[model samples]
Target: MAPAIRVEIEKKHIDEAIERARTGVSKEESYYYGDRLTSGLQLRVQGRQAFWALKYYNFTKTIGYAYPAEDKHLPSVSAARKLAAACKDILDDDPKMLEPMLVKYYGGADRDVKKAKKEMVAVSTGWTVEETAEAMIAARTKPDTDDPIKKSTVAQFRLTLRRPQVKALSKKPIADVTKADLDAVKREMEKSPEGASMIKKFVSDIRSILTWGATHATDMTSLDPSNIWWELVKSGKKKRAITRSPIVDDIVKTLILAESYLERPLPGRFSEGKFGVGHNVLNALWWLALSAQRTTAGTRLRLVDFFPDPKRLGSGWYLAFWAEGETKNGKAFVLPVPPRAAGFLQERMAKAKRNGDSQWCFPSSQARGKIEIDIPVDRNSPGGVTERMAVRDYPTKDKIAKELAKNAKWESPYVDLLAENDIMYWSPHDVRRTIVEVLEEHGIPGGASAVLAHEVRLTDDLLFVDNARNREQYLELRVSRVTKLAYGAGGFIPLKSKAMEVWTNTLIDRYEELHSTYRQARKKAQAERVLKAIYSDANSAAEAKEAAYLELPKIRRKLEDNLTGHKQMLSGLLKKTPPPDAGVRTARIEIELAQADLDAFNTDPASYAIEPSRRAASRTHSAVLQSALKTDEKPVDLVVEAPAYTQLRDQFIADKIDVHTFRLLITERYPITLDMMDDRIITGMVTGDEAL
Candidate 1:
């Protein structure tokens, strides 16, 4: 018996090994004929026979047993070498080539050859961009379920990524898809610049699909379309507009008008009368704004997710809603619901209690028919989300915005009624921007990111254990006071004092003022038309007086109705002894002015018919100060003591109040701007004009 040895295969070595095998000198061991171009090809010798075999990576089994010296069918050493070299070339140049050769030489009985042949076919034909993408999609398995991918994601991919324009690229072999192919797809999509985002997402989805297929299917080539987006970006061909936040006044007016529209069914749609769907939309918008959670989180919000008991964590009735892993980031977290957002949820809960459907916090009408499944059968079971019910559950953020746009008449009355306004419509996500902007205006640093739950680059101080302890202490000691200011609990303003009321009143005032112009114009026009009819007929004076009597009250009543309705709303909001600085004073004054104009018009409709003269003096302010020392124009005489200023400085540092608010408070007795107060005033620094 001889010890098995691994040696480089040469003609000399093969001949010596064959001679030893025939004489039974090394019959117990096999001789490996190693090929530099290929792996696992060997000449096994046992007794007086030798077999050509392979134990390569793909073909992990030995095949073809023949005695080269005795059998007429077996090839000579030179022929065997040539055959091995051909197999090596087949493996390199064409994997499919090995399939037919394996079937011919090794036969179908060879397991490794059968497996390798199957894989070779998949790699050759099934690795086209389209086929590989499909394969990757099919192979995906989600946790705790048999769903390959989310239905919504599948629909999105089909709509955006699998467009007809990409069909040609999809047909190309995955490896053969060049930058040119991707650029062509980009150009095709770029024709509709609105879909610039879709093209970017298409590139990402394709890259992800191909990468997954390459690793998992063992049949696809590496495909990365990331460069396509970069190329488009570098070329400055990509066109995506930045969406601005909706003005806060527009948001409030939209909600109010939407509520009005809800009172009556939509002009053409909304068959179910007063289903509170308008309130649902308004509530959803408010929730998105105040909570700063994405629409998906708001839609899937459940009644069970709320922790109403104020006893826990001293949160004082905060909604500790839990978002699932299905969020934008695959992370589950508990979001602290602000008071305004919680108010919306509480309203929904109250409605649910009245009507026994309390499963979803913000359920759609379709949810009424949905019954919860105690036991799950599949992804489409009763417990699973349904497409029909997804408008409010797993809803698109733009759903509310689109609905508002579709019902534009709901907001049209408030759209351009004020100061040459153009605030027509806005998306629900704009609410997030609105909140962030308002907080920014109030000088709350990093509050926007904190509210939105966006990831921020943490500094060493933020990560320090001592800083963590300080945060814990603040939360524990000042949670109630801070929550009032930040969350607007118990009539506390989340913004500047009476900001929401001022905006609401301004919207109402503008609408009423516009109505007043239309009313006076219509009345005058109607009177002229009536007088013309009388004059053409050559009627008596009694006829003209009769027409006036018939028309004037109706016009007056319409204008008065608007003013009366607004007055009622304002009167409710107005405190009996409102603080002089309170915004309610302005709303009260507006109502009084509107009421006075209405009464004066009723007394003399003919005189009121004339349009008022425009005052050029009021249009622009004069650069020179008035020579008269008017009491209203006089600077405030009150002086802030050093101790009070020092206290204000400490309060600003403690975050008890913002710098702007502190300035407003100190200058409340005076007609002073926030700009006039300056940081120096807050820090008690002596100005050249002031004594410290």
Candidate 2:
């Protein structure tokens, strides 16, 4: 091989030459030209061959590279020189370029070094990338300490938001809420005035929640401050407007109207036992209003709550106990029961006991096992019983009070019953107020606060002394007085004794007639049942007899036919001859006998032992028709007539029966009047008729 060309060039000189070439200067004027000339002369091994070839290659590739002018010798020479120059540049930049050649010399071998290193690291540390990420997040966001917001306050806030009306309104985004929306909700509440207070509370609660969220929510930055609940509250306050209370008279009248509508039937008064717009609920509401307690509490009163002692000192009645949980203050408050209250409780209790509800005096029809009565007995008392009694159970006090607030006669019931009834905002609390007013009127100083369960201190003042003694003395005197006024001497015969007697006699007579009619009906039903049983037994026996008779004939005919076939078969076989188609003939005779039997059965099925079914069917149809007709008759007519007679008899006995009593009795039971009864006598006879 020709001696390889060698050129010594400094690193700086090569960099200078490359820069000059990049700048478009002629290579001959650069540092590389002088170095190339000196090296070419000293190393004469390749002489002008390397110099001319490299120079020509560099010249052609300066602007753009090209193959040598197609001449065979020059082209090969130029290609070799170019290859050598590229190798030199690579060797100069990286000494490791010689590693592959060294590996080739050493007989190239495979190794697991890289993979082993990775596995070693992985085994040493078990944590994955995801576990690390999760740990980091936990460290950043977790609460730092235990003393956070109180759970009870949070629960209250949640409950406040959970009201039905609040929940419905809160479904929208908090930001979009407006006063118009609140007004709309208020308007909806107007439809149920009884629920207005609850609605107001609910609105206030929602505003609080919004304000809390705006101030403390972690994501509050995304919320607009203007849309916050606090903003709504402030805006509302700025645009304050007065709202008028509904006319109490109109509301009371509406309640009365509802009662008039409910005079049809008990179920008619309320659909699904829910106090719809009706009299029963309204009446309960009136009681609540008069009692000066929540409507729900009054309406849900239980017989057990009233400890009526006919011999008690005050009002001949005593509401000695009430449940702690049921009171507004959530503490058991003793009531100085009045005679009127005691009478009402006793009457209700008797009625409930008669109806098989002695355990629950005011049990709801829908809720079973929710018996309300559970009176705490004073174990230390002289004659107290330790065991709590469940004389009657009623709904929770809150529920009863709520229902009463919406009652129909809330306004007029007291006005009509008592004179000088100038009062506003009449409610169950007003009943307590009335008691207080009456006590004060009678010069009983502390009577107002004590009987009303109001917080008051008993000092040495005259008023205080009066308050201390008046409740007890006044209650005793009033009980006797009212008792005499209502039921006369002995407190047994009602003041309306004559009227009650007449009503009772009439009722007894009518009831006797009804009992007679019912007995007759029952006897008729028993006779029909007995007749049906006898007929059924007879029909069964007749069917069995017919079946036995028909079965015997069928068996006899089959036996006779079989015997004749056997005789023919035996004759042919005894003759030891192929008796001319004897087997076939026997078969034909058997088939013909069977056909005849079938034809007889088909022509008259009764002959085949089927029992006649018409008699039983006819009897059943007749019984059903008779029972239906009896049911269709007017059953209510007798019941209706009986109540009037009872009222008339009661009126006669009490000597206080009047048109109002008659009207009430008729409205409650008969709901109709006879033309013969005089309006004036009936009107005069009733005690509360004029008052109502």
**Highest-scoring model, TM-score:** 1
Error of 1 at 540 (Å): 63
lDDT of 1 by residue, 81-110 (tens): 555555666667775566456545443343
What C-alpha lDDT, on a 0 to 100 scale, does residue 247 get in candidate 1? 67
RMSD of each: 30.3, 32.5
lDDT of 2 by residue, 1-692 (tens): 33333555344433443344344433243222222433221111111121222333123212111122222121222333433354344345543342332223223233222332222211112222222222323432346522234344445545545555555555554544557767666666556655556455556655655554454442532334455644444212232243323233422332333344333422222332343223223334433433434433444454444444454445464543334455556543344444544454444334431223323334433333422432211111101000001101122234435555677233211112111222122323334444444445446535445433522221211111123446577445533443332233322232222222232233223333345454465554443333332223222333343434446566557656665666676566556665557665765676577666656655654433322222333333454334424555432221133333433433422334544564455434322222224331121122221211
Q: What lDDT is reached at residue 200 by model 1?
A: 72
Model 1 CA deviation exceeding 4 Å by range: 1-236, 270-278, 309-315, 324-326, 338-341, 352-357, 369-422, 454-692
TM-score of each: 0.28, 0.23
